[model samples]
Target: METAFADYLDEFTRRDWETLDPEAVADPVRVAVVGLGWFAREWALPGIARSAYTEATVVTDVDPDAVETVAAERDVTGVTPEEFRSGAAADAYDAAYVATPNAAHLDYVRAAAAQGKAVLCEKPLEATLDRARRLVAACRDADVRLMVGYRMQTDPAVRRLRDLLRAGVAGDVVHVHATMSQTMLGELGGDTDQWRLDPELSGGCALMDLGVYPLNTTRFVLDEDPVRVSGRTRTRHEAFADVDEHASFRLAFPDGVDALCTVSQNAQHASRLEVTGTEARLISDPAFYEREDRGFAVVRDGTRVDVDFDQVHQIEEEFAYFGHQLLADEPFHPDGEHALADMRALDGIYRSAETGRSVTLDEDAA
Candidate 1:
């Protein structure tokens, strides 16, 4: 007895199952999550656990107690950083998620890659362009995947915006303006001695922490790299020591499209982005990276259209996407090359700040 539902299932199986072998199922990719801090436990590990293609096999942290607490809470086992250094913990996983502090990302990523493990590292790949380039080259030499946490790349709204721009819905992009700022409340506030407040450790001030959002977003949406950058920074608060608490930058793309970005640690909560083109404009409220109650409004010829999006857990989506790529042997986008580009841009920003002039990217430098 032939049935309509049977045919539907058969069609799906025929098209999608061509590359899948029923008898050759592979084991889930084993993942070791580094750092048991706020982000790792509450977000990354949980997200990895929720992913269908990867298993959270282990966790590691420098603080033994913190690691043990998270392992108990998440029902997963972990090793202390000392144990990991001894190579006892390194053999237990096939991949790692490096969620350590900004300063620690380089060393941790190197160690994981040396151990023949694919690495998913948190953003700002490293504190400097030199370090970022070295890490990318090292990963390439090791023949392992190195992915940076540009999680906004997986946001549906961001994806849609990229699609619109690529599809020429907005015509030629002429300008981009983005802002990501919030009061440095609670732990986000530097206590005169916090690592993030230290220029040496944090790489920069609010720009490195929050400003990366706009920088990365503009690049992603425009699908172009900045050829020149000019910027100014000011230390509004004494808490940041030598680091600037507020800063702004103007990035000029190859086609004369300019991107204006601002980031601060002392402003009231506000994150907004707008892309103005020859035909229309796309504006997003709140953070482009956040998955809270947010939407994008398009304006053209005095007509406005607002599109609401479902709340999505970006961490979950990011982890799931990484896991799926691993399982399917697909290449991961925004890999080390992407991180190197952002770091290069950041290098330009710092140069602009130091000299108070626009700095151009040296293509060969990256």
Candidate 2:
């Protein structure tokens, strides 16, 4: 049995959120949400509203009704996608959160950069590798910082996982198993016309939408990029004709570290990740949903230590971090260039699945 140290009992509880005062931000970043989808309306806008460093000032979508409803409900300006792309209501925002479908991300991001606004483009970067490359180049050429919307990176528990791994708390990481799935098809009533089912619009299906959470989160926690990947995909439903329905992939990283990940679009809602190392193991259950109450634990030496981080909202933390970095003129991790690595890896995964072989990212990296 491990003895409980009592010498520092008084210094027990701490609050990280209290340290970063929202009022300390002299100028909060006014944000324009470019997509009026459910994520933008429910998650992005609400997160920005709750953030100390950011405010949602503008909302836009191709659907005027969605724009009107959200803008009116939130008391923000609403514009058509074309108007937003044309830089109308430019003063309303200092940054743009591009939440449009994967294929449409480039146009909006390019427009935002042209308007001298920083970008927080959602994950997968864009629909495909070639377009993702162009998107990153557009931001680079325009000289605006771009950060991909990987909210887990800003989550406290995930950050602590990274810290622990770096401190050798997990010893030498050996293997990781990650699985994430959701009833997205059932939610939308098996709508095949949706962008998620459209390969041209969504890049891939379950892998791109759900599996990327584990894939990217593992990369962030390990601080290592995958050198090679092998994947097998399945399309069991008619809705997944043009895209993957379920996918299982293997990612091989440097230093003998490897991760196996799986995702499904029409299955029971579940997300889990377990990392095993020589000294300790890290586990996260219900890990991928940013809005859910997830649990994390570290187990070793015949003991299990469950972490109880403050239940901070992932999207809100992401907004605050992005805004604070922009205000401080600092660079963003998982920035455009860094995000391209994920894009390349995803592309390689798809290629490997198609060719029924393994794919190495060295050629893409080179």
Best by lDDT: 2
lDDT of 1 at 80: 79
What is candidate 1's lDDT per residue for 1-366, written digit by digit as tens? Answer: 113212322322121212434235357678888877777877787777775666788888888898888778777767877666466777678888988777788777877887888989888887777877778887888789988888888766676677677766677888999998777754443446666777777788788888788998899988888889889888856776678789899999987899999998888777888999998887877654343555677787788877654656778768767776777787788799987778888888888999988998876775
Misplaced by over 4 Å in model 2 are: 1-20, 188-190, 363-366
Candidate 2 lDDT by residue in tens digits, 1-366 = 122222111122222333456677767899999888878877888899888889889989888999899988999999988788888878889999999999999999999999999999999899988899889999999999999998988877777667667777778899999999888866656555689888889988988998789899999999999999999899878868888999999999998899999999988988898889898898888688975787888899889877665577778888988888888777788798888888888888888999999999974562
Q: What's model 1's TM-score?
A: 0.89
Clashing pairs in 2: none
Single out the weakest 10-residue window by summed lDDT for candidate 1: 9-18
Per-model RMSD to reference: 6.1, 2.9
Candidate 1 lDDT score at position 279: 81
- Model 2 — which ten-residue stretch has the worst lDDT? 1-10
Top candidate when judged by TM-score against the true structure: 2
